[model samples]
Target: MTQQLDFSVGMGKETTYGSPSAVTRFFESEAKAKYDVKTIKGSGLRPTKGVARTSRQSISGFEGSTDIELDAPTRGLGFLLNAVMGAVTNTLVSTGLYQQVHTLSTTDPVASYAIQEALPPIGGGASNVHTFRGCVFDSLEISAKEGAYLSVKLSATILKMLTTGATAASYPSDDTLFSFVHGSIQVGGSLTEPGATTLAVGDAIPAVNISDFSLKVARNLDKKGWNLGGAGLRSRPPVLGKPEITGKITAEYTDNVLRDAYLAQTPLVLILTFTSGSNVLQIAMPAIKLKGEVPTSNGGDVITQSIDFEAFDNGTASQPIFIVYRTADTTP
Candidate 1:
């Protein structure tokens, strides 16, 4: 029997934490589910043997990751956004058009998901399905460059992995991808909550030319929250620590706006918008401080500035980071 590389990934929100949910949406992705096992060995000193004897190994827990092409899917990406951001307010903006405003939740008990990975069958053999339950995002990264599509990398901590009773993968047909051609950046914008209203056009930076950008958000979950009597699995959901939002932007060194802000320790707002037909995704950093160096010339090429930034709570906004996604999906 010859093995093939055919695989599929699907996910759905769990009604109860750690309970398996039916896969409702699929992703075009390179995804995997990993198991973490603990090995135990005898520590007693042997009289004649030189090597220690091995005892046993057992499953501890599970984790997984998915690298996805960021698409303007009407419904699918909302699950991921909610998993990371903790809360979302979805509303219908126009006829058949919906807007989802994702924000950080101050309350405990965020959303959890069940992810299924369907492995290819060996010739006529039965395909294996691995389902990861109580899946929560440990970290998420969104990045894009000129002439490239937006990409997302998600790291998740899973409570358990079940290999049985999972449905086959099926994907939606209405998803559209977001590329760099559909992207725009605005720096030093007015800090405004992206609710029903969009950002004003006059808030854009004067003449900055951005080539590439990347943003990363980490949940910093405490993975050792396991109890002694409940087996090696987590007794409760992993405790979330302070979130860290950081990113980098590469742009043509046309002016000193970014450098001057960094040198003077000034705070600024960063907004990135992407449009795919009628769908829109807008990411806003209400307060950010630049930490990158000034642009330096190298060889005869166009000078560029790669600026590092950190997002912070502006004390008035809903959260340190906000995302407004407009699509046709009515439900989150």
Candidate 2:
């Protein structure tokens, strides 16, 4: 009998674009990754009949997406972060501790991965493994609600797919998942250097009641760089275009700080941190402008404000988003 628990997702970094990489790590995901092929149909008029010909249809390319329950695994989370941010710096902090700082890359040829999804074998049949090559994240969303663990959704552009040579799935033993109780948000800080600025403990916003938050970073890749002779696949990797960073925060409407900032068009810094034991994940947006709506009442319920914000470079040389992960893992 087939079982949903038997499905697995594995990934590894690719040294070369569109090249297959060995499955080095597995993820505890919410569902199986999906890969869909793009196709094109010839529009030629056939004098033979009124029905369209099936031979005119052809494959063009592939795209995929997956959702993972975000966890602080010793060595695998950085792979997803690098796919989104394009760059990472890993440093050993102390004994059995390391810090990984992920930043946006300004150059081409960002990191790519070979992702494998293993379907549960049919009754007494071998498992089917679908490997997606040259997988680059086009967008990544990290979200956290009131009573759930942090989740990550990745939309990827795939160059090719293979369905053979299944690799056994293996998970890390030191995985620690972060929940909403382990999260905190700080807002309304000033950035001295805008994109390059780091927030200190004193920069924390005081007495802010937040219910939920989400951040989405998109690397709007140009996926139309196909050539005539490339056999229905991308001739080269998708060209990275400008990055778009946006987010939303739902918080209790207790003060006029956020409303006043929205009215005055103030530039604010927002920091979100999640901690579980010695593992910590911090996302810092150095400069952002709020587009907030006033809180309204509904049947005597507590009023809440939903604020939409966008991150920008703030005229600095550095990238707008910075993610720092402190964990015991040594490598990404």
Prediction RMSDs, each to the true structure: 2.5, 2.9
Q: List, residue by residue over 1-332, the lDDT tens digit for candidate 2.
A: 55656787888888998886787878876445677778888888878756767898877765665555454443467777877888878887768877788888889876778888878765645557888888877888889898988877777767778887578888777677878888888887654332222322426554458898999999998867668888767777877898999999888888888888888888888878888887877887778888887667867998888999999877762658888777776776
Clashing pairs in 2: none
Report residue 107 deviation for candidate 2 (angstroms). 0.3
**Consecutive 10-residue window with the lowest summed lDDT within model 1:** 55-64
lDDT of 1 by residue, 1-332 (tens): 21566677888888887886878877777556676665455556757866755443335544444444444454477767777878788888889788888877666675678888878776745567888888877777888888878877777777788887567667656778888888888888676667654532327663449899999988887756677865766777776778899999998988888899999978888888888878887888878999988989979999998889999977886678887788777776
Deviation (Å) of 177 in candidate 1 = 0.3
lDDT of 2 at 285: 79
Which candidate tops TM-score? 1
TM-score of each: 0.91, 0.89
